[model samples]
Target: MTKPVRKRARETSGGQGRSRPEEPGEGGEEEAVTFIAEQVGALRKLAERHKLDVLHYLLGMTKLEADEHLRLRSKRKLS
Candidate 1:
């Protein structure tokens, strides 16, 4: 007879699940967003320098998102 397969711990565990995403106003999010924006901006410029238009465009969009996050976080702090 063939051996039966066994389920992994994660598969068998009913309570295990993904954690919630961090909201913009939460602590530590601002620094993370700022760092991501900086890194993505650099990558975007590098992609531009190499003529990788598609990759550059995608990174540019991501950069915009991070910048928006920073803006909202700043606005919330000001309020």
Candidate 2:
């Protein structure tokens, strides 16, 4: 029979957040948002080239939101 897994004190303890552990160099949420911002910038350029005004505008907004998220996270860490 298979045994059930158990949680450790450090692994539990209410912990504020970060319940699920991540592998090294996998680049967590912040990295993901930064990557999204970079990609959105490139996509916005492509949309502009294709004369997609609405699409370009949407991508610009998306990039701004991602940037804002990073900014807010940084402020939280400072606090």
Candidate 3:
């Protein structure tokens, strides 16, 4: 013979794992968006600087290859 299993009661509030819902106009979402935008802008600037350095190094090694790289980079920027 098998015994029936009992269901555990769910906590409504004031429990160990209870969490509050986010309210509107709290600015949490807006702050996160602003922070992400700033980080993206900073990363873009760093990438542009790194690309310029790479272009300079490539130019010293091979002008034709550097020109091709620049052309491709410009095409990517346009798209």
Candidate 4:
């Protein structure tokens, strides 16, 4: 049998890590949202075309549950 190993704490500078400020016109948040939306759309289309219940198989969720989750996410995006 193998012995348990102890983990060491990570070292940080001055008890606080440095943070960088966001620059103007970087399009960071907007670009991320747009990319995710495109990918989700593609995945949904692929699932439909292949007649695969992807979420049900991969996530172990019922069809109704997966549909509800997608519906709620779209509703949130609208608002």
Candidate 1, poorest ten consecutive residues by summed lDDT: 10-19
Which residue segments of model 4 deviate by more than 4 Å? Answer: 1-27, 56-79
- The candidate that achieves the highest TM-score relative to the unseen native structure: 2
Q: Output the number of the lDDT-best candidate.
A: 2
- RMSD for each of the candidates: 6.0, 6.3, 15.8, 8.0
Report lDDT (CA) for all predictions.
0.88, 0.92, 0.57, 0.58
Q: Per-residue CA lDDT of candidate 4, range 1-79, in tens?
A: 9999999997655546553444786655445455555566566667766778864254333333545665677798999
lDDT of 1 by residue, 1-79 (tens): 9999998764442344644566777657678889999999999999999999999999999999999999998999999
Q: Which is the better candidate, 1 or 3, if ranked by TM-score? A: 1
TM-score of 3: 0.33
Write down the worst ten-residue block by lDDT for model 2.
10-19
Ordered list by lDDT, greatest first = 2, 1, 4, 3
On the 0 to 100 scale, the lDDT of residue 26 in model 3 is: 59
- The sequence of per-residue lDDT tens digits that candidate 3 reaches over residues 1-79 is 9999999997475767655545786555335445555554555566567787664544344534444555676698799
Angstrom error of the Cα, residue 47, model 2: value is 0.4
1-79 in candidate 2: lDDT tens per residue?
Answer: 9999897656454457644666786888899999999999999999999999999999999999999999999999999
Off by over 4 Å in 2: 1-20
TM-score of model 2 (CA atoms): 0.70
